[model samples]
Structure formats: structure tokens, C-alpha cells
Target: MSHEIEIHADGTAAFVSANTPGWHRLGVVAPGPMTVPEALKLGQLADWNVRMEPLVAAVAGSKCLECSKPLGDKHDDMCVTGDHEGQDDSRIVDEHDTTHAVEVPNNRAVVRTHPVTGLPEVLSVGGLDYTPISNEEMGQTLQAILDQSGAIVDTAGSLRGGLDTFITARLPKGIMVGGADPVELNLAGFNYFRPGKSSEFLITPVRVVCANTQAAALYNFRSRYTVRHSPNAPQRIIEAREALKITFDYRDAFADEAEKMIKAELTIKEFERLCREIWPAPDPEANSAVKDRDDALTGTLMQIFKGETNENIKGKKTRGTHWSGYQTVVEYLDHHAPVRGEDADSGRIRAERALVGKARDTKELAFNLFQVA
Candidate 1:
């Protein structure tokens, strides 16, 4: 999958990940962990100089406009473009072809100039409330907590042509579920566009048993802080550091939940029931394609839970436990689930969905379902 991780025209991607390569494996891969400054530089995420500029449009102008005043010594309309190619009618004079800039009301464009090329790229356009946050600002915001908490960045990058940027750091401590499965905690910070899509910070630390457990951490957790892009965004973001105190709370809660699931045993019938709840029976009027997909999905979930799938749940000692059932769903959604119109790039698409799309909701539902099952 392309991963849409902003591969620039010059062939460098705005991304960096620790230890292992990203899904598309295009950007910088650190041999070990990274400091915030190291990640920003290696990821090519610094010095974007992102800013907002007033949006304008060109329109036909009247000679009477500007009080018919002479522009400079030319004594011609300032808006005039000069010399018409074919003037078939006297009414169509060179001055009539004039166009002038007019401000577009309540709208602004977010742009970033390439530090080297000096070329500008428009990241997004929105109304008055849309504030542009520079990459430098984001780095500073994330750096505060990392400095205080002593966490080191593990992943840092931009997506969707740099419209969305992120930095993730692994905490010093981790939670060991039932004294076996290790779930580490990480702090993820994001700044993006859209009305409801505000900048956010979330905790993870899920030791990934599957290819996408890091993303699954984002999908599964509820503890987080968010701030909208407004005039006071930077200040609000600075204030967010206070929210970091909850890291211990989040870690404790996750550990407690995991322990509960580990202690709660589940039977084959219970597993089947949980699957049915998640992927409910299709209507009688449903098409054959829908039924086929549903059947395949249900079968896959069952296989993952029973160690019949490639995930090999038997290795984790989670078998016959509610924790096993929950992990099975997470693993399936993150790794085993099939993407429609699968291609060589499907892995990137799956990764994106697991991080920011419906798959996240599905994984959360699975976690909740197993919690009460």
C-alpha cells in the first residue's frame, strides 16, 4: 500500500519509525529509539514554516473602478492586462479585459513552503477558524511531555501529503498481562484538518503481537486529550501537558482490564456468540456477495481464536480465555482481515484503516464486547 505518507517529489518521505520499517517502508528507519529532535530531522518533519494566507480570486474589473485613477504614469486602469489578441468589437477594449484581485470572504489557505526549494504547497483550505500549526510547533508541544516523562519517540511522520502529522513515543514502563503478554505504553500526538478532527494526544503501549498492534493501540484506547485548531490552539496545546498526569491512570486501567480478561475464561460457544454479535446475521434479502463476505469473516475470526489461523494464539497461552477472544478479534482486524480489491499496496491501506478508519471502531467494539462477555 502507498500508505499516503507524503513521498515528496524529490523521493524522500516525511516519516521515521524505530527498529522496524513502516508498512510501505519508504521513510527513515532508526536502528534503535529516537529523541524528538532526532525523529523530526530524520523524518524530514522540521521547518515546514506552515502558515495561513488570505484566499483571493480574480474578477473582471471596471475602468470606473479605483475612481478611474491612473496606475503609475501609464494613465491606465491598474487591473488592465494590456493588449487584446482580437478586438472584433469596439466595446471589447483592452481595458475591458481587465481583472482584479478580490478577497474571498471567511476563507483561508494553509500553506507550507519547502525549506530548500522555496516552493509553497497548500496543505488545506478552510474558513476563519482554521489555524495552521507549524511542524516546529508540533515538535515543541510533544517535546515537553517527553522531556518530563523521559519517554523516547518511536514513530514520527506525516500522512495525506502532510495534511496530517504525528509523533509517537514509547514510555519507560510497560504492563505485563497475566505476567506474560507485554503491553507497552506510548504517547501519540496528532495535528490534522477538518471541523471535528482536532489535534489530539493519546496513550498506547500495546505490545503488538500482530503486524499492526501499534495502530491497534490507537484503535483500542480511550484515554486521550484533544484541542481544536483555533486562535488559541498553541496555548491550549501547551496547557495539554497537564493531562499527562493521567498516563499512570491509563496504564493502570489497561493493566487491570487485561488482567480481568485473562482471568475470565471463555468457552467455544461464548466465542461464537461474541463473533455473531460483532458480525451479525445478514438480512434474508441481502445479496449473495454480502453473505459470502460475512461467512468468510466469521470463519476467519473463529480460526484466529482457536489457533487454526496463522496468528497462532496457542503460543500466547491466551487460549480458552476472554483475553484470548479479545486479542483474536484485534489480531484479525489488524492482520488477517481481507481488504476488498486487494493489491500489493493493501497492507498500507489496512494500516491506514486500523489507525484512522472504521476498523478502529470495530476493534474497539470487539474489546468492549469481550470485556462484558
Candidate 2:
């Protein structure tokens, strides 16, 4: 029978199978708007291990343990004849040798030698045993979180590398803003494969009607939490929930800031200045090659400003505002930025990194530019 995850009314998770009499409680599901990785760890679904391979050696016959081949005369010379004085003269022994040929057990060796061949074989040595959370387990964890937090999954999928995954969940309704569209708060959870990189759960506020995703600038730090795939990962996930809950409280503040950007107008000269600052032209003293590169960037930014790029800039109010320009740069970086890598997966990773960095910079520029306005 297949094992299945079950969530009870009390928000506790369990693993159950037809053979088992009762549900095995994994853990109390944390109130989450958490990332898939964090949810898995918190629900006792995922773990980590340090893997090890064994080493071995032959007891006799100078045969190399790795290749299982004879090492010429050197090993042959080490074999000594056994001397049985009064017990048995019939015992076979090489002439002029007195030592018995017996398999000597080495305490350091983890694997035993073959009885007939007298050759030692390598074995796998288990270290830091941990059970990895399967895709199914992650799904269950996400469901439990949604049920407990009263949220619903908006989108979920595997990232560039199948090992890494992401899920975006819409928080409970009632978050609203005046003079602008009602704000929809979403919690995005990213589960990545790398060790120290961990996984992240971040809160993002989006304009409900336009569906434009907004980044929390000053509040970004408070809105995200990351947990490494280590022994204490579960505990870390639990501790972070309190902080994550606080992010939801900032929804109104973030919504107000977004509305300001939407209303803030930008003229041609101001737009050019912002564009140059966001992707500045290279210094005049620099080489012609560098200048050319900067000029290319400048031209691309101009295209985005003129709505000539692929980014769909709808709604007249959003057209000439700082929000539109900011989103244009973000769209270009996220979708059109040139990436360098040997394979598709690597290229996607590089492109993601570039997008994140560019988006951060653009947000910072907006904050600075709008502060004076």
C-alpha cells in the first residue's frame, strides 16, 4: 500500500497507510504563508545527510583493491611459507619460508574480504543519515499550511532545475487601498537544492486589477525568511513564522507606497535621467568598447520607456508614471536580459540572479526618486 499524508482538523500533519492502524503524527503544522521548503522542514518532511563511500584493501596476493589486479612480483615476495614443526610435515609450505598464510583482519577496514578470493571489497558507509522530503510530501506540507493560514495556492511549479520548486499563495482577503486598486497579498515560497543557500518564503503585494507585482523596499528584509537544510532546520522554520506573520501587518503601508508610485508622473527629461541612472552610460574617459556597451544598455532602457519593448504597459495612468518605468526595467531584466551559460539550466540561474539584482537596484532608484517628489 502507498503512504499518504493526512491533515487533521487541528492543523496537525500525519503519514498514514492502509497497513497502519492509526496516523503517525509528523508535527503540528506551522501557521504559514511559508515557502515550500520551509513548510516541508517545519512539518518534518525533509532532511539532509553527508554521504560517504567506503575504502577497502586485499588481504593477500598484492592485488590492487581498486582495479583487482596483481601488483607484479612485489606482492608475491611478501607471501611466506607456514612452518608446522611437530604437528604436520605434510602441510604444504614453500621452501625456506616459515610464516603461516592466513587472512589478517584489519580493524580499520569497514568491509570484510571475500572468503574464497581473499579480496576486500568497498562498501557504502552511511553518515549523517537524513530522509529527504519527496515532492508528494512537499505538496502535503503546502496544503497543510494553506488550510491553517486560510490561504490558497495561486501558482505552484518546478523551477529551472527540477530539484528546486516554488509556490505562490494568495492570503485571506480584506486587504484594501484607497485611490488605487485593492491590494492582493501573496506569499511566495522557493525551495532550492544548494546547502547554505537554503529556501526562502517572501511576501509580495500585488495590485489586484493590474496584477503588477510590487517589491517591499524597506520592508523586504522583514518580509522574507530563509532556513538552511541542516539538523536544526525544523526549529528554525518554526521560529521564523512569528516574524513572517508580522509582514502581513505591513500590507496597508506597502499598498500606500505603490499607489504613490502609480500616481507619480514622469516627464521625458526625468524619465531619461532615471533610465541613465538605472543603467548608466559608461564614463567618457573609458575605452570605446565600454562606451559602446553602455550605449546599448541606454538604448534598451529608452525603448522600454517608449513602450517599444515587449513588456505590456496597459492603462493610461500607468503609462507615464514612475511605476510603469520601474516595471519596464524589471520586465526587461526578468525576461529579456542577456545571460551567459553552457546549458539552459545554468543560463536560467544566471538570468534569475541578474533579474533579482536589477530589480533591487530599480526599486532603490524609485525610492530615492520618489522621496524628493
Best model per TM-score: 1
In order, candidate lDDTs are 0.72, 0.49
Off by over 4 Å in 1: 30-32, 60-97, 193-196, 214-221, 308-316, 340-342
Candidate 1, 38-132: lDDT as tens digits: 89888877778877888888776554243353332232433343333474322333344445788999988778876346788777787788786
Please, what are the lDDT tens digits per residue for candidate 2 over residues 1-373? 1112333345444321111122223434344345555544443333322122232343344443333324431223233333336655433332223222453332221232321234443222212422122344335544555565677654444332233555567777635543434667767666554333556666666556544455545434455576555556566665555567666657666556656766677676887887776666677799998887777776776777677442222423566676666666665555555656555444445334532445545554555554324
Number of clashes in every candidate structure?
4, 1
* C-alpha TM-score for every candidate: 0.82, 0.55
Query: Residue 177, candidate 2: how far off, in angstroms?
Result: 7.5
Q: Candidate 2: worst 10 consecutive residues by lDDT?
A: 15-24
Q: When superposed on Cα atoms, how far off is each prediction in RMSD? A: 4.7, 12.7
**Candidate 2 overall lDDT versus native:** 0.49
Global lDDT of model 1: 0.72
